[model samples]
Target: MAPATRYASGVSETAASSPLIRRIAHLDMDAFYASCELLRYPQLKGLPVVIGGGRRKEDDLLGKLQAAYPDGDWTEDSFAEKLDRIPVEFFPRIEGYTGRGVITTATYAARQFGIGSAMGLMKAAKLCPQAILLPVDFERYRHFSRSFKSIITDIAPVMQDRGVDEVYIDFTEVPGGQREGGRVLARLIQKSIFDATGLTCSIGVAPNKLIAKMASEFNKPNGISIVHEADLQSLIWPLACRKINGVGPKADEKLKGFGIYTIGELAAREPHWLVEHFGKSYGAWLHEAAWGRDDRPLETESEPVSMSRETTFDRDLHAVRDRAELGAVFTRLCEQVAADLKRKGYEGRTIGIKIRYDNFQAVTRDQSIDGYTHDAQRIRQVAGQCLKRVDLSRRIRLLGVRVGTLVKAGTAPHADKPYIAAEETPYEQADLFFTDD
Candidate 1:
């Protein structure tokens, strides 16, 4: 096979070999949600912890206790000692969970049992019943995200924010960026994040974004991997095609049907053949991606296309039998989505709802309104209409609400249809799934 590029970084034969090589680093927080929780509850370290579901009364009690004694002065020794006094049993466990919540993220230890983000808490319970469960705390996560990104920008100014836990940084120009093929800088960033937040991250530095993304996952959890152009065939080709990032389950299955399971196999096929099969744009992009050829630059700032919130029920909810519960949950989701839009200073013209049946079939319905609005009641109203459009005969396992076609709140709204049609067909659900690394 011809040479294929993979990810590499930090002090090696390739370091300083060529100043022209554009070094891009992808840094990902390891078990980010769980790690953030660990900062608040250091006692949970090394335990099988999962962060998901909703906040419980226990969480509220803890908050009150901590607020009453902000510095842990209630104890004789220190806050650490006071924290230790809290029994392990005080933490909620995934066992016997009976809600429609999914694991947001699991600690590496819990991940050993085949549970991860998007897996139902009930399903994860079957794998590791004793795993601890915590609620999603976006406020804390966002704080850490800003802190860590600030650290990166201080080291390497040209960084692109990719969600709340990852970033793409350009290391081609930083002072020590070129040294050791970007390892020195990666190490510094990792140490800086750990020192500031008591969290760990993994980084991969390569010639471009695509290679760097794959490399970041190579070692994982406080690991740094460096990939060079020369390391492509040896490091990249043997991996499964899905490791390429864009090759999702559906795409991977199609590739497998074609007897192309690895990057090497995908690269061997002619670009024209891929285009003929997968269509013009995506096919050609896939061919280039398989060959480890990507020239996309780091986008320092990009507006979000949409904001959404969804949840999977612990048990399937019958549309009629659980009407009240479902209605409340549906309203809450729309409220949450609307709040997200308002918090981000965006209003959207398109409102949509997603439903997944007990049989795993997923569907979506969206409608465009005359003007963009981020009001909770308005969103809930439109989303409820979208819900009415779907066939509610099957029991629902998952529900989601989305707001799209966004614009800055102060700006003029787009020209949209005066009224939305009520009978939109079902579409596949596109819930974001975070994987265990």
Candidate 2:
């Protein structure tokens, strides 16, 4: 009798027998919003630059700097050289700028002082008092986001966008995917992006998305890590439970009660025991995650479900006193949403607005239209209506506009013939019936 073929457990028999291995690359921008800001305001390059705050105050600071140096001679490298010439007071004051705005993103230098995204202005100030704080520039960031994604699609057609800052690329069809040359291809992509945009990113190459995401974060700020299936035990097992995608604070606390601190511990538990403790579906997902088994495909062709633009205030502004200024900002957001949709070859049927209050209470309102459209004027009108529904009694820290239910640009074609006869009759029968003697 012939011996049975030994297959890797959990993988499909067909897949195990096949010679091809699916290669996925997860590429994430290094401090995306903050990096883009540095490109425009070169003076912010080496310093700790925080992006997110009130528009007026940010603009005022930008105006002051522009007046002081109107010739645009500040190259990214020259910023540190001329640092002494610029006065300490020339830097924007972090104290009492606007309403209670939080940090959207902080540069590597600011992060060293224990400041990061979503940290309150008060806390961030305590960490890095002299860090250059700048308001978020959504338009500039969006432009760069589009540029990077477009460049990636040009190089690798099978790219799955994971938001403004990251993407999952399918490199299986690229040349030399199965060999050590895969690293070369990844390097080419990284260099291309840097050469084109002067921005840095980190990438991870793995057989699947689950492993790729974790590997990408292994190194930061212009780094790459490659993970092979054979090295899963050494590379993945030691990670903490919270490192897994779906393990939030609640799940982490629950896992801690079970003495499961690492992926290895979670993997050691029997599937039945995990199911009994964590319920059915989530338990199964947890088991698979522990084993690093995610089969989610890289989605290259789907339209975005939503397109949004948001800005964090430098200081929280009162809803009543800032109503007129906020209204103008909201209008600008709608226009940006429309432009984004048009550029991406999509139109949306739903328009919405998001407001985050001083206390961090977020409220949203949306309106669906009769048909999909990408007109900025139409979006603004509908979004303006949605804004009226939200309570404006409290101070708002952030405002955003979003369009959803996207569809491709072109309309569906209508067939000249009826479908009833075509479906009911066989091809040969229909051909005979339609033919003339």
Q: How far is candidate 1 from the true structure (C-alpha RMSD, Å)?
A: 18.4
lDDT of 2 by residue, 232-307 (tens): 7899989998988788989989999999999989988886588679875577568768877765556655545468
lDDT, candidate 2, at 383: 70
Candidate 1 residues 296-334, lDDT tens each?
Answer: 546657566568888878678977788768777877897
Clashing pairs in 2: 53-313, 53-314, 54-313, 54-314, 98-315, 99-315, 99-316, 100-316
Please give the TM-score that candidate 1 achieves against the real structure. Answer: 0.62
For each candidate, what TM-score against the reference? 0.62, 0.62
Best by lDDT: 1
Q: Show how many residue pairs clash in every candidate, following the order shown.
A: 15, 8
Model 2 off-target regions past 4 Å? 1-18, 56-58, 62-89, 95-99, 302-437
Candidate 2 local distance difference test against the native: 0.72
Error of 1 at 244 (Å): 1.3
Point out the worst 10-residue segment of candidate 1 by lDDT.
428-437
